[model samples]
Target: MDMEILKVDRLSFRYPEEDRATLDELSFTVKEGEFVVLCGPSGGGKTTLLRHLKRELAPVGTMDGSILYRGLPLAELAPETAAAEIGMVFQNPEAQIVMDTVWHELAFSMENLGLPPAVMRSRLAEICGLFGLEPLLYKPVHELSGGQKQLLNLASVLLLQPRVLLLDEPTSQLDPVAAREFIQLLHRLNEELSMTVIISEHRLEEVFPLADQVLLLSRGALQAAGGPREIVGRLGAGQAPAQLAYLPAASRLFLGLAPQAAAPPPGASPLTVREGKAWLRGLPAAGAGPAAAPHSAATAQPGAAARAGEAALLRCRELTFRYAKDGAEVLKKLTLSLYPGELLAIMGGNGAGKSTLLQLMAGLAKPQRGKVELGRDIHTGYLAQNPLLYFSQDTVAAELAQMAEYAGLSGEEAQREIARLLDIFQLQAVIDNHPHDISGGQQQQTALAMVLLLKPDILLLDEPTKGLDPEAKERFASTLQLLREQGVSIVLVTHDVEFAAEYASRCALLFDGAITAEGSPGDFFGSNYFYTTAVNRMVREWLPQVLTVKEAIQQWPDSGSRS
Candidate 1:
């Protein structure tokens, strides 16, 4: 059997009109039946590399070097052959989905491959069952949520039975519970079928443990390549980029507890909550059963319920919503509020009504039996989950000008505002590029820039951090912090638990169409056993209420707690 399934030999690619190569002298190999994860900061060439796998998906760029599949040059392989052997799921599912309904979308690929009708039918039934997609098979393409569309992309790709699968941030849009199920399905595909999988993703907290190999990229260069242990260990030793600081919560916590004078012992790090928990349990008990954990938001200050009734920038009174008149209720008498100068993070499972709530609050969707009232004199701007929805102008620069013009800014003022926004959002590099031509993360930043230019008093963000890399995400947090200081009210709906734990003034769980729980960052995260941060989960025994690695280090006693 061939050990090397796919090989990239000193591959280099340069986008049209680009000065520097997007991928420069990069080379790596994926082994047969192995699962490989490609990780890096945004615009670090992960997407650029993934696009090179299939001949058709290859971007309109200058290329040097070669990619081989089964020892044959990928470029030399016939398009039909490549289609049959190499399947890909892109970062954006809507771009790849062409059919009108879910059933046709899944079957379209298989039919194009010239598979027998019987075979296609059999496979569709099996896939629909495997994905629990039977009920949604006839749903219109546009009606599916972000997570469902992503699952459909995967299901359609699987229907083709390609020998190798390439997924680019496939789970970025999925909620926690749905994402875990998707990863587990991928694992089953790899183990049971001996399939080869190459995925580039930033959501490492859940997928890190399942990767057979970890490849790190930086500015179109290889930063590190090894098993999870090797790469995470390097991160712990401070040998890698700061972008990796928050990738794995368990590793961050374990490394934080290590004495600063001594190096982290080989293989001493943990990458998941279970391993971190065991490592904590083995530590000679902190004497007291988890030092009186700090008080959480649930226990601190006036109740969030009380605050909801006060002066609110955005308020919902018994809000109820649903997508279709015949569809089940999405929100049932749910009440929430956004106070001035505060950022609230909303968390929930996929299809659990989080997006519906945001849409209702943003006026994109109307409620059936409730009222959504904004405070007097509040200007609202909503940034959709898919940044492309907000783009009317072709280029990022034009987008700013168009939005500014709509807001009645003068020509001279528009340019000044555009320049300021470009720098603030770090979109200067792609300001002149077509919005469609830039990377997903960059598009998101540009969309945010356009929204910020309007200077809306209230902002509603749905998964604003979806495509952002670690550094970009950190900068975003800073931007949000600045907004909070300016008395802007922000309602953020996201799947990023760590970001919420670290930055949200208040975190609320939107379960079963209501705000079941709400509190300050420390208070909200520390109380939840399953939905909380990795640090909170691992260090709970010591500092149960701690929400971040920094807080844990700061709260730990100076000497060994012999108590």
Candidate 2:
């Protein structure tokens, strides 16, 4: 076995304000060349454990365990030694970014370490070449999209030439295509470069197959550890806790097979698209056939569905927008609208005007030409990607209560309203915690809770699932459905195709400052080859039009059904 490069023994930590430990007795080890995937529930202490690996980034908490790097006390290592030995890609790229341009950001770390000018130049050239950063060297960091920023962060870490790399949901802000390439890059780092990698993330479809080992965390404790096949097989086979459970569609389908059906070959639980397709072919008469039809009844086109025979609740006519006065146009003549109770999911590549469009619709920005018109009595609300910006109060309860007071509710009524929203968002446990102290996903939910309290007729959300786990994401989707039923119009901007397909009644694709396509989720997602969901990609031959597992299994009834 390769030498252990990272080790954590009985690691437990807690913030001073908390009576409970955030990480309870966690123990794990990463071999020199292993790609370890760390995943679990949103507030399950994944980030807390990751912080312990880097001494400087460790939180101010009561830590009661040991984290050793290369068999040495991590804290005892010199600052320069630690930076050279370990590189980390933070969850939020913006949090760590300091330099004004890409070139300087890459060199800032080396500059701090006071490397000789020659060494710095050599390392900078090598990293820029490795990550294809030569083209972006002079670009302003603020001008980059979420994906580009994430890539820069990755490249910056690589410039350190650290043997072990740690990433915390590094792709949270990236589009699906960008995310795939990034994970593939990590594979190369592990294979060709012999770099040990540990990533905490929720998107398992792409990452699961690439992970040599899986570590499960739940409620601040380590629950399970093993190879992907061993761990995911158990998860699919119902040997894991429901909260910590996340299975690829094929594995779920495999486990859902009839009790009497023949078992898959030992050690053959498929977790990726290629593996899934091959596994399905093993079933009898599974040949490609006439493509399946829409599993749900046809809905009107997304654009028309949003304004069906009524004055649009919120409408933008010939909207053109840009950030800096002299900057490139973010949106050009982008006319869009939302109707009462309609849910529209807008998707596009990074910096493709999705956020800009949402901002324009929410009345947060003004168009250079044309206008955004809200229907009579239509109060609009907007939620940005970062929930922390929405917080002004110190505690979650105080924040919700303040919003309730603004909504004209009071006393017991306000308390009841607060309790109800807290329970629905699954944030009651952290109700009293400081807003900043909660996990990223929890903060997001708290912010949404505040937005909902506004009781707006139209809502605009940008990348709302930035830090959510599979289970939390499902809950968020359900909440949106409930809001739709309550006659709220929502315009959601996200890179999460699965969530869009599952919940969005209408979907639109924005490319190059224009709405390239708009239609029902079935129409838009079914037609796309690259910007579609995992289930769509997996069963495209037989179920080309089905964009979700529920729809796929419904259309191809014989596929997931037991014999």
Candidate 3:
């Protein structure tokens, strides 16, 4: 067996005010040069366990355990000694960054530790090169993109040359491509530098292939621990929640129509798009006939509803927008309208200007030319992709209450409504906690709750479900459905093709700052050239309109919903 670098023995911890323990009798070990992944549902004590590893948990909390580093008790080490030996990259980069410029940010910790100027300069160069941060060294931390900011954070931590690195959902704020790139970089670091890595993240499909071991956590306890093959096998068998099932997009397709299709071989686990495609191609194409094209019922008349002369709730007449001093337009002579109570999803690849268009609609960025008009009496609420920008209060509850008051609600009514919204987002218990005290997922839920409090007639959400688990995503979809029933229109920008197919009534594909395609979710995703959801692509071989696994299973021909 590999040498044990760290160990947790009979560990248990709880918050000062909590009656129940946050970590209950949890024990685990990290081997040198190993990559371990920690995952479970939200608020399952993953973050608490990470705190214990870093020795940052408050001593006042109830404890019945110890953590060892290299056979030495962590509690015996000095705070500075521990900081130098155990580098931590938190989930939120903004929370850890202390300097305005990227270069200063990387050097802050080294300088604080009193490293020699010559040594610091050399280490900075080497670490920056590894993370591709040379170009961003002089840039202001505030000006950097989300992915770049995260890379900087990791680079700063890497400067310490710690034997073990703990990353708490490091890429939760990044896009799909950036997230994959970051994980690949970590894999290389482990191989070349021999760093032991432990990551708690929701992007399992991206990181599972690189993990040496997987640990499952549930309700402050270690539910299971094993190698990737064993964990994936159990997950494929439906022994895991829908969120932790790392089946690829292709397998998800077959699993929807035939749950047994997700079963892996005796010793192999599938966790990538390539692996899934291979598995799917290898399977016998046995099932019902090809599904009919999406929205075949509506495509026969392209503009039937438009020809009926209904007024649009929001309209853009040849809208065009561009940043100051940039001659090139970001939104070019585009025309679109959002009708009341409609859930519209906009899909696109990276740098396709999906976010820019959403910002234009929300009035955050004015169009350089043309017009964007909202109907009279149509209230609007906008949720940015990064909600951290809107936080100002010391605690989550206070923030929600302030927003409620802004909407002219009485203090008592606001408190009541805030309580209800917190519960909806599963944040009731953490209401009084500091805004910075919660997890990334929890902060996102808080942001969504804040927006919903306004009760707008139209909601503009940009990547609202980016960091949410499958269950949270489902709940959000339900909330949107409820809002639609209450006569609220939704305009969402997202990369979740599967989610769009499952919940969006209408869909538009944005490419190069323009809408290349527009139709119902089925119609938009049914195309051969455009991007599509896993379930839709898989079911396209048998059922045309199936976009979600639940829909496929519940409405399968044998289930008696077929005509």
Candidate 4:
């Protein structure tokens, strides 16, 4: 039998002033070399639990539990041993970085560990090559993209060759491509180095299939814990619970198609696109006839009311921009138009200028060449990737009220609006807490609430779904749809292909500082083999128009109502 590398026994914790515990009676064990995925809805205590595993980062809270590393109390471990053996990467990479350049950052860890110069040099060389950070060795940390910074953080942590790694949504800020690469790297480390990995992630499509064990938590309690397939079986049939929306797309689709009375065979639930495709092919006469396209949200053409030969709400014409005078152009002569009520999703790899384009559209940055034109009396609200930057107030309630007041709503109007937002974002419990103390998803929701208070004509959002759980993302999409109904145009820069595919009215591809392609979701995703949604990848050969689980279910003749 494998040895237990870490164990948690009846662990429970409540933050200061919180009404209830954040983590309640959680117990589990992670064996050596196991790839464990810690997943749950937003604010479900995944981060709280991970912090308890590392001595330095554990928060001050009421506790009734014990955590052990190799049969010893984790808290009793020496400071140096805890620091060297337990490596953690936070959600925001920028928060972990302190050095000016990539080389310095990687070197700083080894220096603190008191590793000899020869050993440090050898380790740095190996880590730099592993993360492909060699080219960026001398590059300034701030000049790097979000994905690059995240990779640097991981590389730096791995330089210590920790026996156990704790990652709290490390890929939340990364683009799709970068996120996949990061997960793959983790898998490699776990397999080759026998590194114990305990990762908390909202995006489960990639990690789910690779996880040796999956733990589901909700409302500060463990709902289930088992292998990936076993956990899916426990979810029963049809749609997963709201808190369990992190289920992989393949698993979700399989659950939808399976008969209500049937339980998935032991270790038979499809968790990856490949297994899903094989299972679909095994079905007798699957998609025998042309699958009828379901009633689509895209039926009414995007921006029909706002762009029926009407002038564009915002236009970027031949825009070129660079952060420094001698730096390479971020956006090169890029021209695009945003129609009113258009939820335009700009997708691209890291450093593809998607965020820069949003900054130009929001009028936060001026182009080195050409111009950005706005429709008469149009207002814009821009939400940056780091939601914490958008807040100046100490508390969540104060932040929302301040924004409401700034928007000129007074008396009962401001009160009603703030109340509505608190309900909509499901932030009632955290209203009195400091904005910085909340979970990342909560912070993003709070920031979005503040932006909506502005009531702008156009919304510029950069990776707005970064830290949100699947259910929270659904709520966010509904909010966007409501805004669209009110004729608000939105420019969304995101790496979430699934969200863009399901909710975006139009999707645009940015590459090499220009718009490479732009079209409706169907056309945009159907054409891309590798970059499309998991549902699209699973059913594309038979149902090319299907880009979401709901759409895929519509095409399935026997797919009954999704509960």
lDDT of each: 0.83, 0.82, 0.74, 0.86
Estimate candidate 1's alpha-carbon lDDT, on a 0 to 1 scale: 0.83
Best by TM-score: 4
Show model 1 residue runs off by greater than 4 Å.
239-243, 260-262, 292-303, 559-563
Best by lDDT: 4
TM-score of each: 0.94, 0.94, 0.83, 0.95
Better of 3 and 4 by TM-score: 4
Q: What is the model-wide C-alpha lDDT for candidate 2? A: 0.82
Give every collision pair in model 2. 258-562
- Give the winner by TM-score: 2 or 4: 4
For 1-563, candidate 1 gives per-residue lDDT tens digits of 55898999898888888887889898888889999998887788888898888778889979999898888888888878889789999898778899999999998988887889999999999999999999898999888878899999999988888889999999888877788789999999999998898988888887788888888888788878888877777776773448456358777766666554135666677889899878767655445445756555355334466675568878789988877889888899998888888898999887788888888888888999889998888988899888888888877888888899888889898888888777767887777788988889988899898888888898899999988888888899998888878878899999888889888888888888898888887777777766877778777777878878788766666534321
lDDT of 3 by residue, 170-225 (tens): 87656555666889888988999899999987657667767888888877898778
Better by lDDT, candidate 4 or 2: 4
- Count of clashes, each model: 2, 1, 2, 0
TM-score for candidate 1? 0.94
**Candidate 2, position 494, lDDT:** 91
RMSD of 3: 4.5
Residue lDDT tens for model 4, 425-504: 89999999998888999999999999999999999999999889988998899999999999999999999999999899
| Model 2: per-residue Cα lDDT over 1-563, one tens digit each | 68988889999998977878899998888888999999889899988788788777888979898888888889899888988878889887877899999999999998988889999999999888878889889999987887789999999888888898999998888898988889999999999989999999887777888888999899998877898878755665543436324767666555554343244444777777887778767766466456555532233245665556787788778888888899788898987777678898888898798887887787777888889998888888899887888789878988998888888986898888778788788997888889887888888899999998888888899889888988888889888888888898899999888888888978888888987788887778777778888888777777777777666655664653443
Pitting candidate 2 against candidate 3, the one with the higher TM-score is: 2
lDDT of 3: 0.74
